[model samples]
Target: MKRRSVLFSITFRSAVSSDGCKQSFIIRYTSAGRKKSEPSTPIHVTRKDSGELGDHLGNGHLGQSVHLPKRGSSNSNLGEDIDIPLNNPRTSSEPPRLKFTTTSRPLVTKILSSSDRHPSANCPNRVGAYTFGPGEDYLFSEDKVYIVKNDRIISSDSISKMFPSGPRHVNAAVYDQEREILVVIEEKSVYGYKRKGSDYKLESVYPKELPSSIAFTPNAAIRWHDKHQMLLSNGGMFALYDEYWNKSLMTGRSSSYFKNLPDRVRGISEWKNGKANIYTQSLVFIYDVARDNVAGEGVSVPDFLRC
Candidate 1:
């Protein structure tokens, strides 16, 4: 059976500026059940002679005579279609579409190496616990807080500088881009560190209203901002805010396609009790892990549960 997909038709009209720079106006249309033109602002591009990357100057400007493709009428390979407006003030035609090619199998499977010595050679056992620094662009691991540059240990010369997780294990860690600080999360508390003259020292520790586990939340190294407190991906996206919660954020899900936050990464802690839970935007799944991979919808809300 053909899978269902909501297609978004985006159109960008390009023109060469007087200075030989490319300028474009973006127009978009979404077709699920009804076709509707999305209002967008005109966007300006950088001068070609500037030797810089292409970027929009300002917000998108609304365009005139928007055209939406007729259902099942697009010349492109995308199967879905929609009805266009009758009096759109312009001729109804399909907008320019980008062509996509599909291959039966992956072209390059080995990123670093295909030796199979590790999952992918040059990758550590605990990849989901990896963290990157701000500005310096250095990588660190959450297990022993090993700082690596080109896979070489560049952590502070002192052994004590490492933030090992065992007694008061680091539940989570993120780099604050704006402040150039490293924020660390523990079981019940949070800590922040900033680079001083030569070494990073304790900057602050927020002790009020720290996010707690909602059944499977502690499994999530990163927490969410919604009141639902929903997050259960092993490796997920994080937005480090001055205020702890109630901010815009994204996390991992079980879709096999491209995922915003990775939930299927390896090197995760093993599940206990032969039982596991899955969280989605709308539903939660409970699965028995010991025997067969049998999962049931609608997990029972426990009266008294531990994080």
Candidate 2:
């Protein structure tokens, strides 16, 4: 099993000033389950010209103000002299400090704001959304926000988690309407439950698939249809399965390409025309299963797609 590497970036702009800096990184994985991370260039603090100093001055607490340079002395030449403000004790350091101002690419913004934010105490290393289950009757236990409604925990626990205390976030959930079952996918394993009296009963376990995300058809009562089926994409590939499970559809376009996609694929949504949409840091890829084509941009989409 060959490991792969992907690109990731983080932009930190001084809310104060404008020195203009950005940082990027690379993540590599090994077949032995070991991982290596490449650090990004450091970004210095900066102050924007638009009265940022005044804003910080007004607030007794100037958050992240270390990025700003002080005002220059009246006797110094504008270009030759450093702007070292004498009044502020905080800016007393005489050493030259490089500063930077950055804008988070819309894509990175989306990734950081992922919808999954809960971590089960037992599974602290998971990331994303998950369905947890079969707890004592009438007791619902989700990573966050749990409630029991109609004696069913599926709906209440099916929501996504954006932040988890552990290493990963729970990212996948499947609710069965026919049996009122809930399937959950965490970082390393999958669990399933079926309705039993007022509580759920443990059923079967799906084989572990490393670093994958999952989803089910929108309606529990109606399984995948010729119209549109629920799809799952780890951002590396996609799988489509029906109720019977007799036929499994798998597509991985440009195996080498998607295989090396970002480690953090934020969202996977099924689109009409047999295409699935995959989102990562500042990028949205449209994967056409029917035609085996892929197209997308590393930019923020307009409101239409968001709605």
Candidate 3:
């Protein structure tokens, strides 16, 4: 197997001071597995008045603040800068100690704040996830679904209205992007909804009262794999079901793999190829579906995903 190397670039910026002494440094590196190698030393650069920074060190001197590109601008290569404060004392002979941090693109650009619209204490088990349909984006929260455009909620509707009998408390929810379907599991039933315009139309509902080979508790971590058209749930045990809720695989309670899984599963997600990431509070297990065994386990959940 050919191992791929991932390239990473980090930018460090000093906090703006009253004296306007701000500095920005860029570091580029590549990593494969546990080995990491830096391609170049930190390049110090200052920004021009036009909000673009010159990469060459001769363009600007150190201790000068650089203007970052405007938010949502086309030329914005670097995202939000992690501000490193230089308030601590440093000897003149020693280089200024710098702290490095990470920043990601904002998940929600606009704040959806409303006293009555917020998550309620009465509905403590609210489930939400991002789903897209047609050319529009949407966010499903509990019984309500909101139309999101340009990372902002533009409109909202109650999906419960489409239900036969109002809204049932959702236990877990996962969206199948490939199939354009949203599956929501309630306490006593599993419901599938198809995207219809800005709203979701109820398509199928499987009652839990029916004898099921796979049992799902309230704490089960559910994920839908569109490639296989299968639903996976992991509570205290592991199980796999088809789109119609027919159980295809179920690990026995006494299985060695089931015995090793953590008591509380935080979540489950499809990983690279045919593997799945089973997340616990402290660790994540990479399970290969074909082999029906764990491929690997790691304590750093984010690092595993990066690989």
Candidate 4:
């Protein structure tokens, strides 16, 4: 079955500085249906040197007329058409012309080396809980609490730092609003510093006898729980910790240890009905934390959840 997409033009008016007139307008069009409950799309207007309606810029101008090919009544391949009216100003013609700007699929290729890439990058495991920054610039990795900016770690050191020690863990960092601090969670301990003028002053260290698996709860809260909470797993479980790293609110693991199963914690989330979701390699299990028992069958996340 063939689906048809219709394109329509929408224009916005702004006063051109040269003419000092509000009547002059720039128009934009798109066929995409109802963008976020708003019909308007951005218009790109390149002013011609002459500043006239009919001025023939080298390639094409806003008001130039285009001629359509005589084949199918409706066309999809833009190559078949000639100069259609750029802004769809009416012209005497038999076959109606379509005014479309030339477009091409942008080509992108991976440039990072295998050693430089993380296992989680561009993978289905992207199902990890995330906290989006003010813009789409960075996501806070609860595992580490560091800033993952542009899918790369933000460093206090230079790129050469990667040669000796590799990239700093952005996953172990979190921004604290209450204290205005950036907390860094290392493998076996937690450390934080206050922002004093332009430098970071050392804060207290929380040594972990057993590091609880940490996950960011909804409403931007942090939750930790682990074997101390009687949840047993091979690798570790996800949990939330207080500022002092005292205890965990929840944990993801079987109440009794499984000898055959190497239960490594993957991700943690809370869904509707007071349910918390915990992910292992190939399974997603629902836990009723209040009751402290596994509640639902595991569902597999698809292989294409990568970003």
Q: Top TM-score: which candidate number?
A: 3
Q: Which ten residues in a row are the worst by lDDT in model 2?
A: 216-225
Q: Which model is ahead, 3 or 4, in terms of lDDT?
A: 3
> What digit string (tens of lDDT, one per residue) describes model 3 on residues 95-167?
4579997787667764434532424212212224333345554344557755544333455566566444434
Count clashing residue pairs in model 1. 7
Q: What is candidate 1's TM-score against the reference?
A: 0.32
Worst 10 residues of 4 by lDDT: 158-167
TM-score of each: 0.32, 0.27, 0.35, 0.28
lDDT of 2 at 172: 53
Candidate 4 per-residue lDDT over residues 92-208, each given as its tens digit:
424557989868978898565554544554333332222222222123232222223443434213212211122233223334444554444334344455655644555555323
Off by over 4 Å in 4: 1-121, 124-167, 170-184, 191-262, 288-296, 301-307
Residue pairs with clashing backbones, model 1: 40-61, 41-60, 41-61, 42-60, 42-61, 71-82, 274-289
lDDT of 4: 0.37
Best by lDDT: 3
lDDT of candidate 3 vs native? 0.46
The positional error of residue 124 in candidate 4, measured at the CA in angstroms, is: 4.3
- Worst ten in a row by lDDT for model 1: 298-307
Q: Give the range of the ten consecutive residues with the poorest summed lDDT in model 3.
A: 118-127
